[model samples]
Target: MKKHIIPTIAFALFTTSAYGQSMQVGFSNVTTVVPGGDIKICKARYGTGYVTSPHKNGAKIHKSSDKGHFIHITKSNVTLHHDVYVMANEYNMSYPGDKGEITAKAYVYATALDRKSGFSGVFSDGQCKGQLTISAK
Candidate 1:
């Protein structure tokens, strides 16, 4: 009986550790326009990895019933903010014909469902640059 109980407890602990807890994060209020004029907001981490679908501007927030998908904004775009524009232009001016690409970082307010187990703050992405990292936490 003792041997069987010990094995059962050990199995339970192992299983629990093997499958980490799921996390959900949501963001709102902020909006951004893509290069082609499409608007986007960000939502990160519903389950494990990133998930994306083409959505219209001002569309309702999407929630996945499935357990392993999350949503995030993609396709970095240039911003029209005056300060950012000036800075980017200055950087570009260093190149011939002032034709260098501009890169800017944008931040979004975020909240995570996990308490004391993960992070909750402003998430950032580099616009007009390469791939962005959206972690599941």
Candidate 2:
């Protein structure tokens, strides 16, 4: 009887502690494209990409989500703000002797019941280059 009571209490404590805990969601591939023109740019793949959140801190994509020249995430990346989930990245590329910088951003809305959500944002290189969109596809 004492053993059973102790086990039940332990389980209850564990359950309550795990409630509202941070979590990571992984995706095989998420397409990133330029808006309006619908031009294809890059993709987030390799199966290492994921979005994580800290309980009620909101969703976030860490620096490890980077995929080559396509997207480069940094420690300062904030995928959500004011209850909105916005993912952003920065990458550098070089052509011959010239070097260039690229930045991409996307906002995604998802709930526990949502299997998919609409994602869209902007990409810039130097100037306010262009807008881009993303989708889990």
Candidate 3:
């Protein structure tokens, strides 16, 4: 128990410190899934800086929205891998007869499955906060 506790504390401290760097990550505009050009963040569990959710869309007038995979567990699904953020829109864009203006977004595809990515950002984009994508060159 002593050994485990020591390591856990160290690990927590390390992650907390790493968030200060402010790394930038990018994700391809969700080729696979993105309801209403967004992803709903129904649930999020991570460190103080990170956040995730499953329900990315829906409303009272609409009653309900389509459901996506429940990514509560890390090993259960690959989609639930990196941190996930679902999204949607409240207002519609004014256009000349059916102009395609997709302001609504479902799920902000944040990589690394960490808390800092969703909880913090350079600016205010809400769920689509934090690094866009990061990878080895």
Candidate 4:
């Protein structure tokens, strides 16, 4: 009983200290522009991750708009390794009359100690291209 109690307390302390240092990060107001074209905007951008199993790490850039037409990016899967998280998604473009698939990748990093973070990435669909930028605190 004594041996089990000592190990249990040690394990609890280790896990608590590990998770206590992590920050819940959020980013917002995604904006992008492609050269020779108008600017694009997205409603919200956010990312989250966990060290525990059965919980997934993911990020999203959503409700993008161009000239009053709306495009919703989704909750795409992101890979979290240490301090960085990354994702790449390819899907059919669903604009009213447009026809193509867009490919995008996001790379972001956050310190376990800080709440402020930012990221910039790029995406393209045939002739259409843009960069995504977001900052969170």
Q: Which candidate leads in TM-score?
A: 4
Q: Model 4: how far is 131 from its true place, Å?
A: 3.2
lDDT per residue for candidate 1 within 1-137, as digits (tens), equals 11112232242233231113223333333233345432321222211223232223332221221323322222212222322210011111011122332233334432223223332343433322122222233
lDDT of 4 by residue, 23-114 (tens): 22233433344445433322212212112211122222223322222233332333334544344444333343334234333333222222
Q: Is candidate 2 or candidate 4 better by lDDT?
A: 4
TM-scores of all predicted structures: 0.24, 0.30, 0.19, 0.33
The C-alpha local distance difference test score for the whole of candidate 1 amounts to 0.26
lDDT of 3 by residue, 1-137 (tens): 11112232242243342112222223322221233433432122111122222223322112111121212111111122123422111222111122333333233332233444432212122343322332221
**Model 2 C-alpha lDDT per residue in residues 11-122, reported as the tens digit of each score:** 2233231113322333333333434432233322213334322222232322222222222233223233343444343533321112323343432333221113434444
After superposing all C-alphas onto the true structure, candidate 1 shows an RMSD in angstroms of: 18.7
- Candidate 4 wrong stretches, greater than 4 Å: 1-67, 91-115
CA lDDT of each prediction against the hidden true structure: 0.26, 0.31, 0.25, 0.32
Q: What are the runs in model 1 whose C-alpha is more than 4 Å off?
A: 1-19, 33-37, 41-118, 127-137
Deviation (Å) of 113 in candidate 4: 11
Report how far off residue 129 is in candidate 1 (Å): 14
- What is the lDDT, from 0 to 100, of the residue 124 in candidate 1? 35
lDDT of 3 at 29: 28
lDDT at 42, model 3: 17
For candidate 1, which ten residues in a row score worst on lDDT?
86-95
